[model samples]
Target chain A: MTQAVATNDRATTFDVAAVRADFPILARNVHKKPLVYLDNAASSQKPRQVIEAVDQYYRRHNANVHRGLHTLSDEATAAYEAAREKVRGFINAAEIAEVIFTKGTTEAINLVAASYGRAHLSAGDEVLITYMEHHSNIVPWQMICEQTGAVLRVCPINERGELLLDAFEKLLSDKTRVVAFNHISNALGTVNPVKKMVKMAHAVGAVTVVDGAQAVPHQRIDVRDLDCDFYAFSGHKMFAPTGIGILYGKRYLLEQMPPYQGGGDMIKTVSFEKTVYNELPSKFEAGTPIIAGAVGLGAAVDYLERVGLDAVSAYEHSLLEYGDQRLKSVPGLRMIGDAVDKTSVFSFVMEGAHPHDIGTILSHTGVAVRTGHHCTEPLMKFFKVPGTVRASLAFYNTREEIDQLVDGLAKVREMLL
Target chain B: MNAAAPDLQDLYRRTIKGQAALFSQRRPPAIVTHRCEGSNPNCGDHLALALHLEDVAIAALGFEGESCLICRASAVMMADTLAGATVAQAHEFSRRLDAFLHDGQPLPGPLATTRCLEGVRAYPSRLSCALLPWQTLTRCIQPDPTYATTHLEAKP
Candidate 1:
């Protein structure tokens, strides 16, 4: 474990007030109190740079890409492809062709399930996933298994929300076709050991697909270093516009699989007899892509790069540690997932209070959080609780905000109990 | 028998105190015996509601489970409110309580004693929490041989 000194040295320092200035919505008050937005796991607040990028694209170069040979189209195509290159560099992928854009992580996972899973999976083959997976990751494999007669195998997590690595390794066999799991759980905030999981999956001749929706926004991701066959994350989770995401697939696997959608941009030539598909990325990116969303995502990537991922991760880690200790001091309040290697997500249930009631009371104090099963019903069932209140943090969040949240939860305890 | 009973707010104060006193006095059994199980599987709140009925009135009511405070508090409130009320009155009280919580309407004057639940108006999701015990009691007091003798599961 790295000492606090080393971690502190590596951490990036940011002017929170200036950072908050970049996000216009954070300035507004909710319920007559300054909004303390803590639902970053659901979606992050976009900075001014990303907002301006979307606005600029719409105002200046709002033409369709890949079709028009005109100047506007050329600019749009170049800008859109430039966003792709940014993503390629962001994840340190070997080539630009390996990055395919989709609506979001949900679509990316479905693409893999439909294209890759449908083609390669057969009866008696297994799709391995962890219990901590969000419904997006779990349901796709279930649907694929229903279609292909492949069985879905779940690797369980302990009470602490940490994945049982030994159990996961034991579940792998020659029949395993793919292992799809979240890099960080949206509900529990448990950062799974993906690099080790990928290595184990590879040893058993199975490909790994990581749902990076919760990971990409908080930490540095290198797809090449992860050695994963597929990595999917939503732009919205990374402070970009909604309805746009990136899917990083290994070049060989992506080239081998059929295109996810058949449309204008994905085709080489269309005729009555037959139509051939386009090249690597364009083949997967079917229609007129999310131009504004892509530009916004690129701007978000730039903002994160300027802040430095290592710094962002370190700041969040310290916040989580402080939050954990503070929240623990609240009587009858228990955190749901207490994973040692967790990110700054606090999911907890008050001993005598419903999560919804606690969330409502907290909202009155201008603290916004997600309260429910968080789309992990199996995990909730394992814990034997209805749901938990999830307070997720980002780089812009501060220690004072955590103090406010703790104070708010203390008030909730008084009101309810 | 009724003199426009007391102010509803005063009734609520008394009910809260009465419930607190009753919970403190008996410390109701942690595990219910002669149990009738009711569960809202969707939210994972499971309970065993036990009632002692005599002379067409609820002599006592006790419940055991690990549920949200709303449900548990509502259970304690029910035990305090229904102790002397006839089975018919208990059924009527449950309906009015449900309407007040779910529909956001004021409780009728005769049944306004349960108005401490008004706090629940702000927290809509906990409306189910405040009504679970009452719903269980309604079924517990039904006269039909199967409905009375047999426990039933209520789906949310």
Candidate 2:
């Protein structure tokens, strides 16, 4: 942060050092050098609050949820359901019943594709997705389409990795039954205009499914304002425990869709001849559920709110600008994504060095960067490169770490070139 | 069980870089008796091994790919060591290399630049990159041409 004109005084005074202290892993040293973690997009490091919350749960409140009349079971069930309520408020969902926990974003999307798409989609219908979608977003639609005889259409993006809105609009038709797209691309940090896209999808009588896995950490999410039918995000990427995610759906649509899985938790009554399903959220939640994960996610929501997402966004936006200028200083480095509204991702490819080799050299310097297509093979194919070296930033990431990354890139040039 | 990460200098030695760069300079064989594509989907490493087998020995060996330095270097070293070697000897080398990488067995005698890749064993992740081409070599020497992928152990 050599220079940053903060939008507000609160934004100006983002104590990154204090924020860094909350994450215990920040003190680590990798390969004899201080750690410079830039792989935030893959998975974020958990804070002490989140860790302690999970610890306290297992230590004190360990029991199966949503069943039993014992005190421990009641406390566990109340804590689990309270986590759902916390999520409902965190994403600004219309109702607590709209939140359904899954293994992660992948399972969240699969629930929509399998339960909703399998029932609503049919042969001769079309499902439109963007080329920049992660495999989680693309593969589920592909499988659902293949099973239902529906057509899968991919909307193209420009060279700078921004969505081609004109092309996206042209691709949307009345036959578009489902529209799936990511809120923010993980590989490239290009932020899609989901509000406008969701409106466009509504105009065509299609449902909007947003992959908000990368968005939830960087910015505040208002599912009610986005008005998307389904929004899926993973807790692990947002500084929570793994195997817990939120799928926020409209209540009416969730009522229409069938149960995603069948087990004790999802059923109201069971019979050999016929079985009735439970209400809104539990119908989709089929198993005993990731209770500890949900508890950790709840505490994570508390942590994010206490930190204030607005200040975090502003701080990261400045870091993004700083990183853009700093990484461009490295010779032979070409940035892969240069979207205007993007935040917290720096993807680039250096000449004469493969991404993995760059990654290896960077790792030695304790600058952990991700190399490869990042599960977005189509995006890599579109960029006409094998893969890009992605150094995704977070709110806790400082400009000094960006300098470390640049120095590591210089080391890469020295050795690999 | 490498307790410490491999040093960068030890991992990306001049031998590895020179072999990888030399592969870039040389072109794959125009025609070959056996050719197979090797792929590592985890890191998007794709390599092709083209060989000309005569009777039982490999007459010529060539490669083409944009894989990482470790992978390309390993592929070139395999080609250089196996040229004019019998198919059975190639299989033996492949087995020895796999065992060396996975089980820390000793590298067989008379290897030129292959010993430079010993640093890869410390990097459990990059071990797949070093083995991608050898795995492709194993599949290429077979009677059937199958697409090869990087794995520590050969599939039965």
Candidate 3:
């Protein structure tokens, strides 16, 4: 909402060209045209620094962490643990012990559902989640509820794709055990007021789990300030590698919850009679972790710190505004989400062309976009659309790319209509 | 069908455009012998196919639902071509069409309207759109146990 810092026809706070240079894939062409990637909500392009870090780990420090006493093992273990510290600082978690690594955001949420939800929720209990949540967030709770005999309640969203806080409050009851929702809607880009929602859940004596997969790349997150019991996010969404993510849970809660899975590294000691579990984060991290992925994520955090999230956020907001205005000019193009607080995601449907058709057309022009329900099937039903062509932006994206996207859509209209 | 020539026109040729535009005017039969819904869950396309069988011959064929251009066009052209075909003949045509789309073979005769769709053979990802209706029609006649539910997918 604030004025974008621009000087001499350039965004002063952020330089998109420089950011693009750091990502090697941005230089490549798709279908003989320069690639205009707008699918950051699914996964962001990795920076050269992050890529090098992962490569370096594999080249020099490749070893299974935490067990071997060799020099390579020590370096790998140090880098992997240091990545945990970076994540703890990234979200401002209370302690390093609260940060546990998993495969990705989906696995992180599943971990919480399998452990916390199963242990606490029982018959007649409730798990409240927003309708706009990705299936990863929704289905895990559904599984937990099905197992515990607890009811799963959904908070409604308006036509604008904004969650109805009033409905969320009403859904909260004495038996409400957990409240889980996305910090930003991946399909719609609606930014939920998670802090206020977490407080409301706390009022009902319920713990909150925030899906920060889409939010972490766009804004600076302070988990302690939001006071959510659990926060899950993906590394791939934040310029880190796939198959690596973080789950930040309150120590007191994690201490009581059972381990998500049983495996080698999670055990403290083994005997013929019984096996004692490891402490804190190690208890939750069952198998050998993605050491190289953690190292890559650490480098990505360093890159973001140098670029500054505040500047990145401001530049992206301006781009979102420009994209929204340009997309509105395309005749018969209906924008799906118009939440007041939104990121640089434009989901729309042309009058005659289906989203898949539009996406296929755009792909020819090297304008990559996502076309589907985006795993938010319930939200699609609410909007009365089968799916939408979603163009999600990142800080490295420029205004010219958005112009190309609008031009591509015009071509789609000509061909299909 | 060359991947090197990745043109949008190749996929949305004139034939496909015309068929997609003409789909709305075609009406569904008043009565149906067998009906099933086919969906590409990845892209949220829905195709509801119905058949009217008169002594194992397709007396009338109709469909209702929404999908991408390739899918709509394929469904419309398929219904128009297969109306009077027997169950076995319809399946045979579908088999040949599948072979053509997948193996890059020549499209079979009696499927003249769908020939222009040979362009879709290049775009592997969009191939499912062109095959959705035919697959649904197969389910309608054969009645696979997997597709017994309203929703039918190419794979289990």
Candidate 4:
């Protein structure tokens, strides 16, 4: 394949079909038509490498770790630990111990809320979150505050769906113990200015926790560089299995927090008298871990590494631009979250039709898109509509898919109007 | 050319015409200014059903929202069928409609007009899209005093 030299901020042009070929599911048909999987923000399609990695783990290294003494056991333990290192490097965490595996971002947030919020927060202390947060990010803080008598405060977002940074700064105070926000909005795809937010939160001695579920898969993340106390993300959104996710905390902070779950693997010793929790990451990871999921995530990371994140980001941005142009051409279509810096998720409402109708019509054409509040109900309420049809793209997606979507939308206009 | 031919079968199919005929003038009591809102949280098909009930029978039923063809058509079918029927009859019709959409069995006799929704049998997820309005109507009639208190409680 001929490679065009990169100039400016754009990626050097490459063979798009070759990239699409790596994902096997993309070849499958839905409703007797080619599958144009655009719901990447919900979950991504797995490459053969990630799928095979999980298969290889079950086929070859099928033994449990930490408790076994045999050779297979040793191999399993080493592979599992290696996956942790992969996760550590993926987000640029300071140490592997700081990267704790959870079921997904939702569980990770709950863990922090139950553990840190229970231990550190008290009455009159405030937990600050933004209006743009997903239900996962918002509810956990609300739960924690409800239990602790701590007040929950919100930083509002402007009409563009961008967080009001000045309002956020104004809300910060000595009583603000924590600031939890999504790094990128799953519904709107607006990439929040998280690093700056984290820095500001730190200035007030408030711990910052980022919901990186949408951010990590699309963009390069440097936890150390971002300097957030805690970050949470799901592996499924990053092309891994659904159950596996990572929660990265600062080393010192992770060490201080209590164990989230009381079960096997999290305890060093459990006696009738008292129990001693395991150190660092193990303390957070309770019960039998998602061994196969970790292996799958490691494989996904390996695949992304080989393709190069910069290349993937550039290709996705091009697809986003193409989608924006194509979708804009459709009459009576209004785009939501038209931020200057955004991810490849498009949230829009047709002028006369509801998002549900638009999504249904699109599905008939074999173009799958998410339509509704996108689990950000409060954000939906803020926008004063039930929901919008979201067509989220990934690196493997092409401009042709966007054209199909636009065409499908036009057909919907023809039928509905 | 022949009045008998056009009268033998209305402009549309017998089923469509029958459904349309059954939908004639039955405005609901209190006009149920607010319709039942139902959403399939998984795939995002949301709809609201407004109704006007007259005693035990439905007087007028209309829907204002959007969804897939199956859903929209189902909404139209639901409003048409339930408009002149009692609450219990509406419930039974919804149950049969649900089964039919799920590819279980066809509705018998004139009520078989629901066959139009068979187009959605292949798309199971869209079944919820189609049934959302009906489900919301059921919620409205289920006799919960709290239903009047919360405007958005029926959403699922």
Best by DockQ, which number? 3
Clashes by residue pair, model 4: A357-B67, B26-B59, B26-B60, B27-B59, B27-B60, B28-B52, B28-B53, B28-B60, B29-B52, B29-B53
Task: Residues A127-192, candidate 1: write the lDDT tens digits.
Answer: 999999888898889999999999999998898999999999999999999999999999889999
Question: Every model's Cα RMSD, please?
Answer: 7.2, 2.6, 3.0, 5.6
Order of candidate numbers by DockQ, starting with the best: 3, 2, 4, 1
Better of 1 and 2 by TM-score: 2
- Which residue ranges in model 1 land beyond 4 Å of their true spot? A1-12, B1-156
lDDT of 1 by residue, B42-110 (tens): 344555677677768766778766555456667777777777788889988888888787676677765
TM-score of 2: 0.96
DockQ of 3: 0.50
lDDT of 3 at B149: 26
Winner of 2 and 4 under DockQ? 2
Give each model's whole-structure lDDT: 0.81, 0.88, 0.88, 0.79
**Taking the candidates in order, what DockQ does each have?**
0.13, 0.46, 0.50, 0.20
Model 2 CAPRI quality? acceptable
Error of 4 at B133 (Å): 3.0
TM-score per candidate:
0.79, 0.96, 0.95, 0.89
Per-residue lDDT of candidate 2, residues A1-417 (tens digit): 223438566435688888899999999988778999999999999999999999999899889998988988988998898889989999999889999999999999999999999999999999999999999999899999999999999999998899999999999999999999999999999999999999999999999999999999999999999989999999999999988998999999999999988998999999999999999889999889999999999999999999899888888988998999998989999999899889789999999999988998888888998988898989999999998899999888988899999999989988877
lDDT of 4 by residue, B1-156 (tens): 111112211212333333433322322335674456666665445555567777777777876543444455566677766667998998888788778767558795545656765655555555676677677787877776112211232221
Assess the local accuracy of residue A261 in candidate 1 as a C-alpha lDDT between 0 and 100: 85
Q: In model 1, what lDDT does residue A348 have?
A: 93
